[model samples]
Target: MRPQDSPTRETKRLDGRWHFLADPAGAGRAERWFATPLQARDGVEEMPVPASYNDLTTRPDLRDHIGEVWYQREVRIPRGWAGERILLRLESATHRATVWVGETELGSHEGGYLPFDVDLTDHARAGELVRVSVAVDNRLTWQSIPPGVVEDTDAGPRQRYWHDFFNYAGLHRSVWLHSLPQTRIEDITVLPDLDGDTGLVDYAVEHSGQGSVSVQVLDASGAVVASDDGAAGVIRIAGVHPWEVGEGYQYTLRVTLSSDGEVADVYDQRFGVRTVAIEGAQILLNGEPVYLTGFGMHEDHVARGKGYDDASWKLDFELLDWIGANSLRTSHYPYAEDVMDYADAHGILVIDEAPAVGLNMAIGGGIFGGQGYTTFSPDTANEATRANHAQVLTELYQRDKNRPSVIVWSIANEPESDTDASYDYFAPLFAHMRSLDSRRPVGYVNVMLSPYGKDKLAGLCDLYMLNRYYGWYVDSGDLDNAMLHLRDELGQWAQDGKPILMTEYGADTLAGLHSLDGATWSEEYQQDLLEATHAVFDEVEEFVGEHIWNFADFQTTKGIMRVDGNKKGVFTRDRRPKAAAHRVRERWTRIRGRA
Candidate 1:
C-alpha cells in the first residue's frame, strides 16, 4: 500500500551559538552568553543548532572523549507569535543537560540519544530577545559513566566484556523551534498486525484552544480505507494491517484539525504492518520463527565524530546485509525515526535501546552488576533508582513503539542489578509494555546473580538472551567446552524450559590491522570463535537464536586492544568488510529472495 509522507517541519528557526567549557566557576559568567540583546547588537558568536562541542570548539586533535560544554544562543519571538505554543526542541545532548532561559529555569533532561523538548511559549516576550543557555554535561559522577569504563579481572583496567560502541556526546540530533495554534497533535501511535493483516493506532492530540480533529488512513491507490471523527484529546484506528519486516504492507495517516469549521492544521505519517514475538525460544517475525544474525551498531562515523548525516545509514545497512545480518541494535540509545523506519521496511529487525548505558558502572565503584544499579523491578526499588528506571522505560516505549523492527525494549544490558527484586522491577515495566502492545518481547542481557537469576527470569521472558563472552572473558576458545557450558546451563532450565537466544557473542577485531606476529584481529580467530559458538547451537536444541556483538566498529571510552571500543565488528567503522562478515552472510542467506 502507498504510504503518506511525514509532515513538513516548521520553516521558522533560531540557531547558531558559541560553545564553552561549562563548570561551576562559569555559572554566572555567561549571562551575556545567552543574552539576546547582546546578540542582536552583535554580542555572541554564531554556531549551528544540534551540534557537538568538538565540532565547534578549539579541541582539534581529538581522541575518544566526553566532557562538559556550554551553549548560548539567542532568539526573539516576533509579536506575531503571541499565543502560539513555542517549544525549544533539542533532539539530544551528550549525557545530561539543563535548559535555562535567561535567569529563569526551564527544565533538565537526561540521556544523550533521544529527542526532548521544553515549553518556552511564555518564557519569551514579543520582540524581546531571550537567551538560551545549555550545560551539556558528560562528566563522571556517582550517577554517570564517562565514555571509558570497563572491568578487567586480571589487574588494572585492560580487558572486559562490554558491547563495543562509541560514546559520542553533545547535541547530536536536530534542534528546532515549533509554533502551533493552541490545539495540536501531541503524540501518535500505530501498531501493525501482519497475521491479521490490520493496523491499530492511537493518536493523542492536546490543545490549549478548542478545535475539531479527525483521522484518515489511505492505501496505495490514494483511496481512504478508514476515516473517523477524532476527539480533541485522543483518537484510535483499528483493523489495519500493522507493519511487517518483509511483506511491504503500508498505509498513510492524515490527521486534520479545524477551528470554526475551517482547517487549522494537518500532520501526516506513513507506516507499515508487522509483529514480533518470542514463541517458545525463537524470535517470531510476522508469526514465523526468525533466527537472527544480528549486529550491535552505533551512530558515530569515524571522521564525522558526533555529527550525523542521512546517507550513512544506507551504506551501513548495505554492509550489514553483505555480512548476512538480519538484525541491528542501536546500542545504548534510541535511534532517529528515519533509520528506525528504514530498518522496518527493509526486513531488518531492531532492538531499539534507551539512552541509558553503563548506569551500573557509575553507581557501584564501576561495574556492570551491582545490587543498587537498576530499578527495573519497581516493587522493591529505591525511590530514586526506580524513578530513573521508570523515566527511561516510559520515554523509550512511548517514542519508538510504532516501528516494526523493534522486538525488545532492553532496560539495561549489563546493569549489575543483582536482586530477586530485580525481576520485580522488570515485571511491572514488562507488564506495562504488554499492556501497551502484547506482540513484542521485553528482556535485558544477564548480568547480576539474584535470587531470581536465569532460572526465574527465563520463564518470565518470551525470549531469553545472553551477552556471553566465553572466548574473551573466560579464555575458553574450545567449541566443545563452550557447548558443554551452554548445555549444562540450559539443562537446568529444560526443567521449566524457556527457549534461549544469544543476544551477544564474538570478539573484537582491528580489521586489516595485524600484529607484529603477522596475525591481525584475524579471521582465523573469529572463525574459531564462531565455529565453537555454532557447535553450541548445533548441540543445544533449546538454543534458537543468535545476534553477534556488533555490526561495525564504533567509538568508545574503554580499551579493547589499544582502542576504547572493541573493533570486533565484522566490518570496520568505514564499512570495510572483515572476513567474518562473509562467513555469517553465507550462514544466514543460504535461501535468498528479496522483496
Candidate 2:
C-alpha cells in the first residue's frame, strides 16, 4: 500500500503471460476452475496480465464478454523469503475479484481501481511452485460504485452504463508478489505543515509487532535535517523550502521499527511541506493563489484500454509540460499509484476524484438525452450506492493522503446535484469526505443541468467544480451564444463567493479537419472554443482553474453520437498534437510566465 518497497522489503512483478478464460455463462465457480489448471479447460488462451483482455483478443465474443473471467499463473517463492511474510498483491482487479492459491480461497475485494493484498506466508514454502488463480467480474449493478445494468440481449449479455467512456475492464494494473519482515511497519502517515520559516511534519506509524519507532527527515541531498523518536510526533526543520506549483521540492521521511535492539523494518516516505486553504474566493496553495491549467484525463490508450503503460504515462506528463499546464483531475476514478509519484516528482497539481460518475439515471441515454426520472431512487443509485461511494473515498484518501500534489478531493463528476434527492445523497458524502481529511477542499463536478439556483449541494461544498460544455453540448456550434451562456452561469456561481474551477470545457475536434469558418468537429472549432472559454474564465474573478474536457481522444460506448471515439482531446489518442494543443500551449505559457 505504501509505494511497495523499502530496505527491508522486496517485490517481484507477476506481470507476464497467464492462462485466461472468459465465463460468459457464469460457470467457472460451479465448474471449480480454480482447483485445476486452466489449460485443461476449453477456450483457454494465453493473455497478458496488467492489460485488458477485451482488446487483446481478436474474437468479438471475448472483446464484449459480459460476465466473470479467470486468470491463472504459477509463481515460485524465493529461497531468501524463507522466514519472511510473503504476500500476493494485485494493483487492481477490475470491478471485483476473488483470489485462490492452489485449492484454497485467499480473499475477495470489490473496488476496481485500488490495490489489495493476500497473505501467502502460511500457504507456500520457500523455493516452491504456487498456483495463483483470480476470478474477476466486470458487472455493475445499482449496488455498485459506478452503477450500471446488464441486460440479456438476443446475441448475448449487453453492458450499459451512464458514463460516456467505454467500460474496458480487467487486471488493468500490475500484479506483485512481495516479501516483508515478520515484524514490519504496516502504515505510515505524514502530514506536513508550515509555520513562518519552519517546517513541521506530523507523523504516525502503525506496525504489526511491538517495536520502538524512530523517524529521520532527510533533505534532497540525503542529509538529516530533523530527527524524532516516537510512534507519533512532529519534526521541525528551519528554513524549509515550500513545494510550489511547477517546482517540486521533496523531503524523505525515513521510518525505522526496532525490536529487541535489532532493526525490524525500514520505510522511507516522500513528502512536501505545503498546505492547501480556501480563503474568500480563492483556492490557495501554501498561502498563494494557484490557478489550475490542465485536462480531465483517463488511463486509456490503444490496445491497452485503461491498462497502465509506462511509455504512454511518461509521454502524458511530457505533453503536459509541453503545454505549460500545472494540474489535472483523475476524472472518473483513481489512477495508478506510480502516476501519482510522477505528478509528485514533477510538481503537477492533482484534483483527486472518486469513481462516482454516472450517478444520475435521467441522462442514461447520454449527456444530451432526456431528464425526467429521479437520479436517486431505490432501484437505481440509492443508499447502497452511497455506501460504496463512501468506501472508495476512504480507500482513495488512505492511499494518497501524504502526497503534496493532491490539492482537492472531488467526490463525483457531473451528478444530478439539482434534485432534492441528489442533495440528500451527496450532502452526507461530502461530509464523510471532510471527516476523512479536512486539510483539502472536497466537492463534486456539477453538471450543466444543475444551475446555481436549482443546485442544492453547492452550499455544502468548500469550492465549486463545474463541467460546462457550452459551444459543444449546450449551444452547439454557436460560439457567441455559448460564451454568453457561459458568462451568465459564471456570474450566477460567482455570487456564491467560492473559488470556481472549470473542470471540463472543450469541443470534439477531428485531426486535420479544417473549415474556412469555425465549424463543429473541425480543429479550428476546438481551438476557437478553448480560446473563447479562456476569455470568459478571465472575466470571472472567482475562476481559479480551467482543465479542458480531455487530454486525448479515448474510446467510449458505441453510439450514433461517437465517431470512432471522443475527439475532444487537444491531441490525438496516439499522442499527436492538434491545432488546439498549440493554441493552449501559447495561452498557458503566457499564464505561467505571468505567475
Candidate 3:
C-alpha cells in the first residue's frame, strides 16, 4: 500500500529509545561490523535513541582518548503504518554507516549531523524488523572536540582543538523509521511575494519509478484555499499572513502529490510568511527593527556528555527560555534538527552552520596547528576534502530549509582571513552556498579585527558578523576599553557599508561552581564582566545585537592554561545556574520590564 498522499514527506520526531554499540575506531570497516547474518539480527545494546554517546562511555573523559562507537538498532513499524510507505531516517551519524534490511543493501551515508533516509516499502515486510549500522568520525575531530579527559587509545592518535569545548560522538540525536508514500513532496521553495503581500509556493515531487503530481494549499481549518494542476513550480496563496517573533502568527504550507487523482504524497510544513533584510547595518525581522539576544551553545554537559538525552534538550530549552534568549548560535557547527525545531516552535531564531571549524589559525598560539582552516592550504586537503565541505552545506540546506527558525546559513565558523589568497579560495565556497539557497545569508566569524576582508562580499551576506575575544585575550580590558576595540573593528565594516553582528562575545565562568578567592574562577569576576557587557551592549544598538560567548559550559580539548573547553557557561556543565546567569537574566527581565 503506497502512500495515498506524499511518499517522500519526512515525519516530525519527538522521542524514542535507540540501540547503540561501543567499539573502537574503524571497527565497522566495509560493512564488516554488522555484515554477519546473525549480527544484523537486531537487539544489541539498547541505548536511548535521540541521545548522545558520551553519557554511556566508560572513560568519562573530555579529551585525549581513543575509542570507537558502533550503533545498531531494531525498528518496529507502527501498526498504523502497515498500509503506507515507510522508511528509516537518521538526523546524523558521527562518521560513516551502511544501512541494511536483512542483509540486503539499502544505502550508505556519511558526514556527522547530516540527515539521510532510505525507502522501506519494498525492503520492509510490513511488520518486520530492520537494522541500521554506523561508524563515526570521532578521531579526526578530536582536536576539534570541545574539551574532555581520555585515558586510553585502543583507537588512534588523540585529536585535539585549541578552542574550548568537548565533542561527543555517536548517534547523538535521534533515529526514526517513518512511513511515507510512493510519490511525495521532496522539497519546497516559498518565494513569498512581498511586493503585494501575496504568497508563492514552489514545490518538488519525489516519485517511485515515475508518476504525476498534484499540489494544494490548505488553511488552518483544512479547506483547500488554493489548488494547482500538474507539477507547476509555483502556486499563489492570495492575501498572505506575516510572521514576526513576538507576534507569533504562522501557517502550515501543505503540498499533496497525486497519481491520477489518487493521492501519492503529502508534505505539510509550518512556516511564517516573513522577510529578513539588511537595512544599512541592522537586521530587520518581519520589516521591524529587531535585536538578537542569546548565548553560544556547544553539545556538552557535565556528567552526561554527548549521551545527553531528550530530557536534556527540554532542560536546555527551559534554561534558554528563562534566560530570555531569543536566538541560539549552533556554535562552530549545526546541531540536532529537533533542537532547532524546538527553537522554531518556541520562537528562537537560529544561525544554522556547517561543521567546517578550521584550526589553522595559530593553534593555541603555539604551533598554529589548524590556522589555514577550510581550504587545507598547506594542511589537510584532497579533492575529497573540498567535496566533503560542499556536501556539508548541501546536507545542511536540504535537512533544514523548511525551518522558519533558521535565518542564516553559515559556511565556515572562523577561517583565517588575513590574506587575499585565503579569500580567493574562500570566495567560491561562499558562492556555492548562495547557489543552493539564494533566500538566506551566508557568513563566517572573522579570525580577528582586520581591514583585509571587511565586507569583501557584502552581497554574499546580509549581515557582517565578527567573533572576537578581545577584552579577555588582548586587553585586561575595562568594558570601555573593550568598546574602543569593538568600535575599531566595526570601523572597517562600517566603511564597507554592511550591517554588523557582534556574533560572539562573553567571558567564561564556571556558573554555580565558581571558586571564590581566585578572581580568575570567581563568580564576581564573571558577574562584573556581564554587567559591563550589558552596559556596553545597550550602547551599541547601532552595530548588531550580541549573543554571549556561550549558553552552557561545554567541552574543549584545547586544555590550555585551564581545564578542557572554557568553563564559561552561564550555567555549569551540568545545567546548574551560576550567579552570572541570574544577573544576566535579571538584566534582560528589566529590559523587557518583567523584572
TM-score result, candidate 1: 0.80
Which prediction has more favorable TM-score, 1 or 3? 3
In model 3, how large is the Cα lDDT of residue 105?
66
lDDT of 3 by residue, 1-595 (tens): 1112235444435245455555544445554665653344343455555555565545544223345556555565555666666776766666555576655667877666677776767766665656655545465532221211233357634554444445556666666666765454555555543446676666554446355666667765677767776655766778876655634345665665666767666666666666776677677766676677787787775654654356888999888778877787887777876686677666678888787665335444222244334433434433345567777788788777767777877776665455455456567778889899887767876656343344344445567777766556545445568667666656656665666676776665654445554355567767776676566556554566677777777766454544655766788777788788888898665654464
The local distance difference test score of each candidate is: 0.59, 0.90, 0.62
User: Which residue pairs of candidate 2 clash?
Assistant: none
Pick the winner on TM-score between candidates 1 and 2. Answer: 2
Locate the minimum summed-lDDT window of 10 residues in model 2.
365-374
lDDT of 1 at 464: 61
What are the TM-scores, per candidate, against the unseen true structure? 0.80, 0.98, 0.84
Where is model 2 more than 4 Å wrong at Cα?
371-374
Candidates sorted on lDDT, descending: 2, 3, 1
